[model samples]
Target chain A: MTRYKAVIQYDGSDFLGYQIQATGRTVQEEIQKALTKMHKGQKTVVNASGRTDTGVHAKGQVIHWDSPFSIPVEGYYRGLETLTPDDIAIVSVEEVAADFHARYDVSGKEYRYFVKRSPQHDPFSRHYALRYPFDLDESLMNQAARILEGEHDFTSFCSARTDRESKVRNLYAIKIMPTEDGWIFSFSGSGFLYNMVRILVGALLYVGQKKLTPAEIKVALDKKDRTALVSRTAPPQALYLWEVFYEKDNKK
Target chain B: MTRYKAVIQYDGSDFLGYQIQATGRTVQEEIQKALTKMHKGQKTVVNASGRTDTGVHAKGQVIHWDSPFSIPVEGYYRGLETLTPDDIAIVSVEEVAADFHARYDVSGKEYRYFVKRSPQHDPFSRHYALRYPFDLDESLMNQAARILEGEHDFTSFCSARTDRESKVRNLYAIKIMPTEDGWIFSFSGSGFLYNMVRILVGALLYVGQKKLTPAEIKVALDKKDRTALVSRTAPPQALYLWEVFYEKDNKK
Candidate 1:
């Protein structure tokens, strides 16, 4: 069997999430179904860097699977392209080492969230952005973002449902940049807990709205309690898995 | 009664068409439903600048409606905002002269068509752009567009189902500009018949693909027969009613 790693991009508007669930459409089910078809009735389990929530999009989600057939990488790409729905796209496929694991081998990750700063909702961008009607102070939001960056316990920002034993994560950087009519919050880190990026963005937005101060965010982080942060978790539609970084030497 | 002229915008992926038909959900029905609800059971009729087919989006579709209540223009805008779906937005609303008619007094119109010139389809833009998986020569397309400009009988490019008495309309300009990953074909004209913009774009794409020469397009125009053009009418998803121009002296 040949182990192959592939990069994927998807518009997650219609998907329930990235993982398989009891009901509703999902990204994993779509890809696995396509693989099973290509393999001719044999079930093929695939592993991914991580699963995203419903309405959360992805630009470079990574996954790996073992193929029983000796098909060229381009052929696999084409097969998947024809089999999967239009919303899912295989960006690239390459043969990987047998020991390579999509989830365990991940060195870092990058996520981005979008917020539309207009008072009125834009019809064209309603599905892709979180429409915030109120004014936002960009500099305040950035200051709050800076306070949250670094290696720290992120229990305050993680989802309550996260099953991981360790809530400590190394958050490398957080940058808020201005787009034409909105702001894009980019986060790069060693890893993220369930809903961590969305929660972080929500907290920063509170800072921008003057509801919470930068010092208040620091206090919330020190508390390490999910309830300590009063901000609502950011919605899923505007969130995206921008990239998953693995060890450069191992792959290239 | 105060006559209001409003500019509306909508993402037409979920809409059947601009006109109120016997069956599926349409932009006109959505707007009219909102108006009826706002009027408290009094059915309010609206007249649009023009009707667009299914999956055809609009950036600045003008409409006129008469209101029985004495409400401020901003009040009308806010009312529509709270009543309409997220995919539809009221760009602006103002009281216009009673003589102003949305359909009859139209001076000119502009339409835009997007073509993704990449071989691979982008999942994020699947609803908005036409994924043409072939290389196209920009200069050739522009040369062909230039030949189709000016006043002529555009019956060949008009849909055969159109019931208009006159098919002779002035096409003021046809500009094919290159976008980052594709091309934007902008059409500005005195008026257009059914499917004229889409058919024109289809013929130009044929010219770009070398299937038909620019001179052949001229002959097709002279033929004034819809069957003379072998190209297919471009799909509605990539088409947008960019703007509907009116006489400046009437309204600013």
Candidate 2:
């Protein structure tokens, strides 16, 4: 079998999610269907670095698959581009070693959350950014984001549906940059739990609104309880999987 | 009765057109529905400067309507904002003279056509731009646009369905501005016929592609025949009703 890794980009507006479900359209299902057709009805499965929730876009998601036919990289890319839907694009593809598993070899991940602070909603960009009409104190949001950085138990910032036993994860950075309309929050970490990024953004926004203090956010992180968070989870449309980082040799 | 003139914006990706038809969703129907609800079930009619085809967006389309209630400007704006769909927005509104008519009193109009020159399709901006993968000669397009400018009979660039008795219109300017990705063609004229802007764009694109010479375009315009042109009409999704102008004293 020939193993190949690929970088992918997709607009998740109409997709159920990145994973295949019992019903509804999904990014994985589309990609797999394209692969099956290329393989002449042979089943083809793909593994990704992680699954993104519904309406969460991706600019540099990574995936890998083993193919029985050893085709050129350009041929594979062209074939997938012709078969898959327009919303999902294979940015680049390359051959990889047999043991280079897409999910298992992941080292770090980066996510971005976009918020539009314009008082009037932009109809064209409604599906791409979350509109926050009210004023937000950036200094307070930055302080709260600083407190959330570093290794800690993020149970209060994770979803209740997660089955992982350990809630501990190390966050390398949390940067907030202001744009013309609003702000973009960037989070880099070793790994994230289910709904972790959305929950963290929700907590930070509460801090910016002065409803919750930075000290309160620290206390909630220490509590290690999902119910401790008072803020509602942020919507999925504004979140994006920016990029995935692997070992130096495996980087693309 | 109080007459009001309003500037509007809408994302036309899901809309059938700007006019109310026998079936399908339309921007005008949505606005009129809001007005009827505000008038307590009484039907309210609205007249726009012009009609936009299916999937054509607008940044500054103008409309006028007469209302029985003389509410404050803010009240009317807020009511419309609350009642209309998220894709439509009321940018500004004001009471206009009773003698003013939205359709007949227009002095000029501006339209913008967006073309994406990138070889790859942008998944996020699929509805906002036309992706033209082939190389284009900007100078050639500009030469053709200049020839088409000024007062001329534009029968070659007009739709056959238009019933207007005269096709002679004075075009003030046709500017081709290069953007990061592609080019934006802006047309300013006294008025345009059905699909005039799209047809002009198609003919210019043909010039840029070297499929038709600039001299041939001049000949087609002089022929005053719709079938004289070889290029197809451009798609509607990339066209925008950029702005509408009125007499200096009636400007809002």
Candidate 3:
């Protein structure tokens, strides 16, 4: 079996999530269907580096799949491009060894959350940004974000639905940058539990609004209980999987 | 009656145009209906500087209306904010003299057209930009744009269906600026004939592709016949009424 790596981008507005589900449309299911059609009715399965939630976008999602046909790397991209919808684009495809597993080989991931603070709603940009009319103190938010970086037990920030045994993860960076009409919050981590980034964003927003102090975040972390933190989670629409990184010389 | 000047913005994807029409929803009809609702069954008439065709967006469209009630300018904005759908926004409302006319008092107008040259379509921005995959020489297009500046009879550029008798208008500026991922063409003029900007964009696109030379545009302009020029018109989705200018001392 030949393995290939694909770099993908998608507008997740209509997707249920990255995983296959019985009721709603999903990015994985659509790609699998497209691959099956391309392989002359043969079924194909793909493994992604991460499973993004519903309404979450991606710019550099990585995936790997085994195909029966030994087509050149460039041909795979062309095949996928022809089969996928206009909302999704495969930027790159490359041949790899059989051992390259998208999920197992992933080393880190980056995500960004966009907030639109304009008083008037921008109709064209409403889908991609979270509209918050109130002014946010970015400096305060940044200070809170600094406390989030580094290895910690992130139970308070993770969703209650997360099934992981250990809540410990190393948050590499959390940066806030001001945009023309809003702000962008970027987070990089070794791995994220369910709704971890969203909850972290919510906590930072609470601090930005002066409702919570930076020290309160540390208390929440120490508590290890989800209820210790803010109940609100940022909406999925404004969150985007920016990139995924892997160890050098990986099979795929 | 109190006159109010309103600055408006809208995503025109679902509208038939700025004018009220029998077939589909129009920006004018939507705002008028919203105003009527706010006034408790009293109809309100609004006059704009000009009409935009179906699928055209606007960022700073200016309009004026007279109302029987002396509502605060903020009240007008807030009322419209609640009444108008998510696609439209009344950015600001200010009281003006009774004599001010939206159409007649305008000194100049600015319009912009966005063209996406990338092969891949941006699904999120599909409704706001025109996607053209073919390679275009932007420099050649700009050279042709200079010829379009200044006062002239734009009979060839105007739509054949236009009812206006006067085809002459002063084009203050015609500029092509390169964006990060695409091209933005801007036109500022005293007035524009029906479909004039779209036709101008079409001609420039043709010139950029080398299908027609810069000299052919001048020839087409001199011919003063719609058929003499290429009939291609840019899609209305990419066009935006960017701004409107009026005399500072004008009462309304």
Candidate with the greatest DockQ versus the true structure: 1
Enumerate residue pairs that collide in model 3: none
TM-score of chain B of each: 0.97, 0.97, 0.96
**Regarding TM-score, does 1 or 3 come out ahead?**
1
Q: What's the best-to-worst order under TM-score?
A: 1, 2, 3
Give the clash count for model 1. Answer: 0
Quality of model 2 by C-alpha lDDT: 0.92
> Model 3, which residues run further than 4 Å from truth?
A23-25, B14-16, B20-25, B116-120, B131-139, B248-252
- The lowest-lDDT stretch of 10 consecutive residues in candidate 2 chain A is A243-252
Best-to-worst order by lDDT is: 2, 1, 3
Best by TM-score: 1
Interface RMSD of each: 0.8, 1.0, 1.9
Tens-digit per-residue lDDT, B191-223, candidate 2: 998899999999999999999999999999999
Q: Give model 2's DockQ, 2 decimals.
A: 0.73
Docking class of 2: medium
Candidate 1 pairs with clashing backbones: none
What local lDDT does model 1 show for residue A17?
A: 92
